[model samples]
Target: MASIGLMGEQGVSAEAVPSLHERDLLLRRLADLAVLPPGRVTPQERALVDMVMATAVSRLDVAQRCRIAERVAQLPEGPRELTLALARDTIEVAAPVLAEAANIQGSDLVEIVRVTSMDHRLAVASRKILPPAAIDALIEYGNTDVLRRMLENRSIEISSRSMEVLVRRSASEPELHAPLLERPELNQRLALLMFWWVSSGTLRVEILNRHAVERRMMHIAIADVLEGGLAASGADEALRVALSLVHPPATIAKPQLTRLVNLATLGQREEFVMELAREARLRPETALRIVSDFGGEPLAVLAKALGLSRQEFGDLIVAVAELRSGYVPAKSDIERITAVFDAISTDRADLVLHLWDWSISGEAQFPLPAEE
Candidate 1:
């Protein structure tokens, strides 16, 4: 990283003033061209300015670029060369800046991508703010690095088509594919695939360390996927990967956990739910709420959460019944009872057999604590 030296330093001051003046002239010219009629500037001069502005690193260059772009934007002709060159440069030039300069419509930018060689920088820029057509081209040919960097931009919404691109591309390289995991929203299918992939040690430790809750959920989901036969051999691998988690497992918020169990549990893993019940130690009402909330199949996720094996979950059901029979229990009590069950129920089918009967009796009734 060679320094350019300070632009306003003693020796630099004299030269800096002239640059500022030049920049001012370019800015005014740019503004003038924006409002000028279509025929005001010749195509050749407009093209020349576009090329210079696109490649310029300084504000003076951008000013000049803007002027030419404004002029060319009005022309029937487009400046494909300028846009392509701008994309090749490393400086953080913005796409909106280029679009503004040429007065070119987003549709026109799409046309440029169709005819031009897809430079990585241009592809990245287009993903940031290009029209739908250009977006299509970037998806078709953008490099993995460029696409990964593009994912960091909040501007790009994950649509089905975009998700398809990520899923298909994910198989190519794990390192480059890591950023997709950071996205807060993804299509269900894509999220599922990513969950499994990341759970197998494909993801970097830093990512798991930085995003604890996300990583835990991902680990649990991978276990569920393996158990469901989607990734048959993945269970051991997923667990092995999960063991690498540096921090304690993420805490599932009691309210959210209860809601998910009560409302979103259909077709989910029974083993996971059972494990979660043991760890959460939820009272019968809370457990039943979680189970009913889940509508069914909360077992698998629950089991993973509590770190319980299948046999232990059955005992947890029995313990839950006892706790429920006693009284409406707190979230902590539910966890304690299930933990006690996990420690004792080694392989007792009899204990396991009693679980369903207890589960049917449901969670104990309890009053909520007053809000502080």
Candidate 2:
């Protein structure tokens, strides 16, 4: 990659200044013409553009240089050399072009990001469509300020893997919770987990309700009932699950589990998990790791592995959620949870089960400490 050389190092001959001045005047006139309804620019104005490029732009003062970049940034055939130099210039000179330049390509943007200041990067964050390579660079190079700008810019597209990393980081980023919640792309399961880990603000309820509504507005009534149930129930159930270290095969039958799901009682949910851990060939503590989670994906995965019906999976979602929030799961909550359960392929669930067992005994412990 060739370097975009620093401007103004080699001064232009004094003879060029008069010609450069004329070119600047011509450019300003042409730029003014560009904003009005379509009309042909005079041939002299056209020659002025080419003539300005022929001059050493670096000899121009900062104000004059920035003016050139601002005008060119908006034009598709605006001088590439001019834009490139300005993008690498001081933040004030670069910001407008970086933020709104229609002609700038991803490669130039990435280079600018690599070499520019935070303000410049923030400008890059607002671009309408970022290439994967550029997005990757932004995620790595951006600091907290740049990241906030990027997240807030709806035009930015963060890849799935980057989102996962952001979600994990959100566990510790209290300031980021609201933005992450407002981010519609977040998977509900991860969003729920984030909500649990963050503060006990009213925003939690609002975001959760919004999440539910977005998932399926039609189910809002049931969700509201369950959410209302939380008020009636109180957070008294500090739901805890304690089970024997090991269990005999198939001791807790399907009917028992079904009844447990139906009653949606605290003890029953705990007992159901204990039996389920044994069936999934996971330790009670390890399996409880999933059940105690803030989201329903792990629970859905376990329910799928256990061969539960779709309704049973829905029950598990409602039961755990109600016990936690002291309210019924919202309509969106039910729809989201059931959808996750249905989406899990049997093969994936089984692989997850095996991996869970192997991981627990090998290099890893359950990630979130099992509170229960």
Candidate 3:
């Protein structure tokens, strides 16, 4: 079949163009040489091919060069010099060999990528089993077409960091969404992160349905994954969330916080945690978690949300610390907790409080955004 693709960069150069008759003879000879045994190019064959090519002109147009490249690329020892020459030829002549020639190893792909245009880069991107170095180069320099082809090329492996970059870039390229979502590398956390940034409402819902964190699941995950997590207590976290929802602690009036603060001051830990839970609309276990945390940041934030005065906040810290052990917070710890209260805005505290209301009790005071 005739070479069927674009004609590109339609000219070649040599020190001497052989006479028409000489050119015809060399063309016939090169054709014969291209059919030689795989990996069997003799020293004699190389010498003759080189001598003739130096003077033998290619009346061969781009298509014919592509044809010659096709044939030469098939022969295991076709002619390394000739295959390389054609591979560096115009985009049309080079693309087929670059895309499908298994013999074009990683290093050769690298060199071709450096010297050729977009067609070559795209071809390199579509190859099966691309070398890590070749993938690195494509990720760095390949254009949109090349990037799309690589993302779709399931046979190729992409580095994680490169996939991360692609995920980030997809924020801008709406065209990239489908293939990116299908990628095995697009895990739940990254997909959720991307969902918030994506403009597509449909995609956002799809992501939420597929990867949404249930409240119980989230609390359990935190309990399992957090540093110094609450797992040592040996309580089932799901049951805690369940009980918090079913038999909640009674609500405490604002005046009750001062009374609870006094009880906490007297080392009555249970009364303080229970009343704090009541005031904050948290389960006793959840409230106790914040109070028991060594860093004290959660309690600080909750206190800030509850509108506790700085002095009451200090006493609350001391009372909660006495729950687990006699570990009085250091001066630096006290400073950090105080900073949390000062830095956290009221609106931020309200948001957290609302989420606690919604997630734990299935009640939201604020309406969700209207669906598009």
Candidate 4:
């Protein structure tokens, strides 16, 4: 039996003892515990300790959080398995607390997912890791929600084998199939592979046409088969499948269109230029010509190789119209080009803006039709 003491006493009833102050003291100890010098624990152990602390605290004060993140980042590569083990231990210790922290669920916390397996916990964690490619190689569990998490991982490389697995699973379980329908970027090769799965009688056509299926997927489906490098039979067949879908009206609004145009103009992806033009309902030739404005005659040479007429070649100049306005020929602008071409000819008309546009814009005929 414990005796109660007056005021501050050594022996007291449990109820009489100060509880709040003890917890307060414990918190202070924990706070101090969080800041031990780097030498106190090995880096791997330090990372483990952080995961534990991260999981334990209701809200890890900013300082502790920073320390833990720093420790984890400082870990060298090569022995990922050890680091992963520590992360797992940390997750087990603090699961409940971290599961509630909003910050832990965000992209800032993707490193946590990188260390964990695909499971219910990962599924919840992945909601914050958008665009699914985050854990493409990390996922081992086949939980649809976990697989759905893959949708957010943008870099998820779905090969034929992986796509086949997903399609089969989706057919047997419609709930699992739902997320794939929403991703517009699903490439044509994957789409064709799905069709092949259906053809082989491994997947049901009825399920393939479910209301969950997004119509825009059809466009990428064809584009992927045509453009995505894959050794597969029947490219023409895939194109036919794309044409069969009565595609919904395009949704590229003004801001998006302007953004795409800016992207096309600034970047040199002829493929992107061609695709953007196709999206805008412009001819591929027109799109090619626009990029040619900045690209100069190298692109024209490519077109010529593809069989454009010499008149088309003449149309590819960038000279400013009317010499009075502060303007110069592209040749005058390029010192290397001036040195090279100046030796061959003095006529700078080839660099004249109007003549160049005429040559490129299909206005002026070539001096000589391409040596056909």
Q: How accurate locally, in lDDT, is each candidate?
A: 0.43, 0.59, 0.62, 0.38
Residue pairs with clashing backbones, model 2: 219-331, 223-330, 223-331, 226-327, 226-328, 227-328, 230-326, 230-327
Reference-based TM-score of each model? 0.36, 0.50, 0.51, 0.29
Error of 2 at 353 (Å): 15
Off by over 4 Å in 4: 1-24, 28-120, 123-125, 130-133, 149-174, 196-372
Rank list by lDDT:
3, 2, 1, 4
- lDDT per residue for candidate 2 within 1-372, as digits (tens), equals 332222222344557768875664454443344322223455456545445553545555677667666766677655555567667778877887787777678898888889888888888888887787777677778776776777887876677767655665665555666677767677644554454456553554444444422212333445546445445555442211111111111233687676656545654667766766666656665576676765555676667767777776766777766546565556765666666667655544544544444333321422443333
lDDT, candidate 3, 53-167, per-residue tens: 4244256556666677676656555555566666777778777667766666678777888877888888778777798778778867787778888889999877777776776
**Model 4 agreement with the true structure over 131-168: per-residue lDDT tens digits:** 34434333344466666666544543454445545644
**Which residue segments of model 1 deviate by more than 4 Å?**
1-103, 115-128, 199-372
Candidate achieving the largest lDDT: 3
Report the C-alpha lDDT of model 1 over 73-156, residue by residue, as the tens digit: 344444555544443333333344343344445665555555554453454443445555555655666666556665666665
lDDT of the structure predicted as candidate 3: 0.62
Error of 1 at 333 (Å): 30
Model 3 poorest 10 in a row by lDDT: 360-369
- What RMSD, rounded to one decimal, does every model reach? 18.0, 14.3, 15.0, 21.1
Whose TM-score is greatest here?
A: 3
Between candidates 2 and 3, the one scoring higher on lDDT is: 3
* 130: Cα error in model 4, Å: 5.2
